[model samples]
Target: MEEISKHTIHEQDIVEMILSIGKKFERIVLRGAYEDILALFKKLKKKEQSPQHYYQEQYDQYQPSAPPIPPDSAELFDYYCSFEVHDCYEQVDFEGKGLVDNVYVPLLEKVCNIHPSLLECQRKRTYKYSGWAFNALGRVSHFLETTKLEEMNVDACECLQMLWDEVQVFGFELSWLAPQVEFALNMEKFMREVEKLEEEKKTIFMRIQELRMKFKEELYFLYI
Candidate 1:
């Protein structure tokens, strides 16, 4: 159909499908689409119609559409959760200073025993008892701290934010993961900003290259 219509006639239809696809959220899993969906949701929130203006007609109502979850819910389902922390630890040595067994495991066991109705608590928090999980969290952190923002995994940062959100309301001060969560959320804005800057960097570099050429030279290096 795209070949026949040249992707023009179905453009609005495609947009509508994207807007209505609440259940099929994996379609917007990438950070770029995730941000766009957020921007639209924010626009709807900001320009909400007055109560008087909204139901003025006979049985007619003007309702702005909304997404299934809020903008930040993207990484709430941590994709990294499936990878086993135990497996990561089998080949290496990582001591928890007696914190893993006496503290982490006991807390996790208690949470699992909770009635599922309470908080819908899925006790899947990573305690970094494994060397890999520890380093993986730091992998993106390393990128964020340095100039290589593009290398950082936005999903990891977002998962940290979601975890922090849960921990805040967990009724106690679990100081264990607090600092790591702070570090993750503090630099979350760079996920979008660095992407924007990369695109702008490309445009500027392309223009500069074009100007550097006498309308005829071609040189290729890194674009962004």
Candidate 2:
């Protein structure tokens, strides 16, 4: 118990020291701080309740349990192939025709744009998990590079490769300057659309097969 208390005190002191140094150099970006913060985040995140335990506890207590998701359409997940979606997805040369242009590129760019913003707390910066953006950046880059083009899901929901999960905690900012948080919120909507599109695509292809079969049968009866 005494050892645990000492560790907690040490953690608290370290967090305070970091925040103090960051604030002292608020207008200037700390050299190497960005990379350092990014590297330490994994261990920091493992700390009992994170370096922002008190802040998070307060945040959770006051904040609403959930945000209401607005009604939406999946128009953004559009595919413009002259060929049917089922056929496009099945063909070897399709090369993720629409997904590369629309979803993957945009999502990658969005992740790339987020930065740790260490020590330059001009106006709307939150120091909570200060360098978490680096994790998001790395996670996104790895996911994009490792995922085969032919097998890439537009909404990024591959079995163990869920985009959201890959970039969850530090990926989204927990502070007032939540650039990543906005992206994270947008992902929620994207996943919901994925669910809708998957079902619609399945049904549309089934219907297409049925109609083709019907047309063939009618022609055979008429001609024969």
Pick by TM-score: which candidate is best?
1
Q: 33-58, model 2: which lDDT tens digit per residue?
A: 43343344443344324222333343
Superposed model 2: Cα runs more than 4 Å off? 1-177
Please give the RMSD to the true structure for each candidate, in Å.
22.0, 31.8
Residue 84: error of model 1 in Å? 5.9
lDDT of 1 by residue, 1-224 (tens): 22523544232233344446545444333324434544554554544443223322421221111001111322433354321112111122223311222212322333323422212321243333232232332222222233222333555456445444543443432343344344345444545654555565565445434333411111121111
Each candidate structure's TM-score, on Cα atoms with residue i matched to residue i, is 0.28, 0.25
| Residues forming the 10-long window of minimal summed lDDT in candidate 2 | 64-73
- How far in Å is the alpha carbon of 56 misplaced in model 1? 54
- Report the Cα lDDT for residue 185, model 1: 56
Q: lDDT, candidate 1, residue 40?
A: 50
Please give the TM-score that candidate 1 achieves against the real structure: 0.28
Off by over 4 Å in 1: 1-154, 174-180, 186-188, 213-224
